[model samples]
Target: MEVVVVTLAYTLTGRDTEIVSQLRTVSDTLQTAPGLTHLRSYRGRQKGGAYALFLCTWDSENSWRKAQEQYSPHKLLQEAHKRQELLVIDPLQWVMHYVWGYTRPLAAPTLAAIHLMSAPPEQEVLLQNGWRRTLQHHVQEPALAYAFLAHSTTPTTDEAHEGPVTVLFCFFSWSSQMERDLFYSEKQIRTMHAFSEQGSSVQILALEPL
Candidate 1:
């Protein structure tokens, strides 16, 4: 699957009307979009800093590109941007971060989390390999629906001017949020935490399907 992670940092705090309306419009169109297997929306909770994430998976990169040019949501979003009703801190930010297809097909009942990692260039491979190994145990868990990793092709804002930085994206899905929380709280997940600590920094986004 080709996953496109579109993150928008809004200027306002808490449910801004225009942003919510725009997102609702996009989510509605995404439900019936061709080639789109899944669409998860996330609203950031930071008090002073507010943002949202739209994680979308498609059959291929070509399909995604086609949607950008022809899809209704894309057209709506473009119009919103033009009117300054929907402002994103990084409008050009888009990442292709799913390297492999999902372990299970996308479904409405599943819940997922996205992890954004950055490490020194030299430690990139090590971080990727270690994290992959750490997730092996969870892959077979009955509650886990799917999981995959992706590396960023461009430098993230935080890494600009720093030494070569690699962005690592990983997504883990479970049948439900309750099941995911239960499984994630286990002591064994600490091992994955340790592996991630090897990187310079990491940010995790718990995603909800719209």
Candidate 2:
């Protein structure tokens, strides 16, 4: 697929409703970009108050780069983030992926999760394949709406440079958190934990729409 999705997830000192209000000006300007297909926002809760995510779908990497040069929402948000209005718990773990697989979710996703893992360049293949098998288990549940794994390609071009792949991200959406819980048993939970142990900087962050 030619589509590329860039995700920016961060913990907000306040709710995204306020941020949404602030984004009106930026969103209006962004909508006119030719390569930008969609720009969406999401919010979720855990121990902290709320976390926000912005998902941007672009026609291709080149298109996304051009938009960045002209008007980068990421930079605008980053400035707000530095001011503590939309702070990121971990700046390094943001999600960005190219659409290697595609399947529309039957139902609107009320909740979502992004699995992040990274290791040395030599170990990227092991982590990538392992996560694919892990994602298969997640999609088996009836509540699972849709899931996709990142294409195992280096940044810039798919032609591949001297460096090997070193990180991978996979996303999955659920109809609801309750349905997600009902589908997992103690055995299943154990299996999930087992997969998490295979790589470093592994994180399974829970999320919901804004």
Candidate 3:
């Protein structure tokens, strides 16, 4: 079966406590939705709670779309929307192929990082290879939980935004936050830094399972 990760990055006009409560309601409602196997809710530490990422996994892209329509008019969702305005910065759907490690029977991770990256068209092949190799090395660690690497087949690009570029999504989960931070500060991440373009960067959003 194909695994798809749908990331909804949004900002709320209301307070964090209020927004999180609404998210919990959404999560509770999704329990009955078809095809949705996992739901992980996260707040972006990089922006001081101004942003949040909702990572959800489905059996396939088609099933996910069907669930969207089915759940669009749910009363729980309508109630959440009424409490606060959700300004979605990016609604990205990634069809991820397994590079290394096992990610099944999904559990709440202690900490997870969501990365959204853009690479020049010319470097697409190299970019994918670099990410795969780096991920493979990390998978060897017993503390590493799971890692997924995917690129957007249909990325949003316009004249105002940069022209059509390869969008890469990397999600990693660690046993603890300290290990996660160390992995980035040490040599492993530096190797990736040297392998890709200078402009290629990822936002390290600290995560929690809803």
- Per TM-score, the best of the predicted structures is 3
Candidate 2: RMSD over Cα atoms? 5.4
Best of the candidates, lDDT:
1
| Comparison by TM-score, 1 against 3, better one | 3
Where does candidate 1 stray beyond 4 Å? 1-5, 14-17, 28-38, 62-79, 100-111, 154-161
**How close is every model to the real structure, measured as TM-score?**
0.72, 0.70, 0.77
lDDT of 1 by residue, 1-210 (tens): 465645434534544777677767767776677888877666554545655566666777778777766553445456666766565443434556555435655644457776777777667678777767666655565456766777775665464326667777777777877878776786667767777776658877666553
Candidate 2, 179: how far from true, in Å? 3.0
Which tens-of-lDDT digit does each residue in 71-185 have in candidate 2?
A: 4666655655565466555433232555334354567677777665555555556666665665555556454665666633453222233443355666667677776675454
CA displacement after TM-score superposition, residue 208 of candidate 3 (Å): 2.6
For candidate 3, give the lDDT of residue 156.
51
Runs in model 3 lying further than 4 Å from the true structure: 72-79, 86-108, 158-161, 197-201
Q: Could you give the C-alpha RMSD of every candidate to the true structure, in order shown?
A: 3.8, 5.4, 3.8
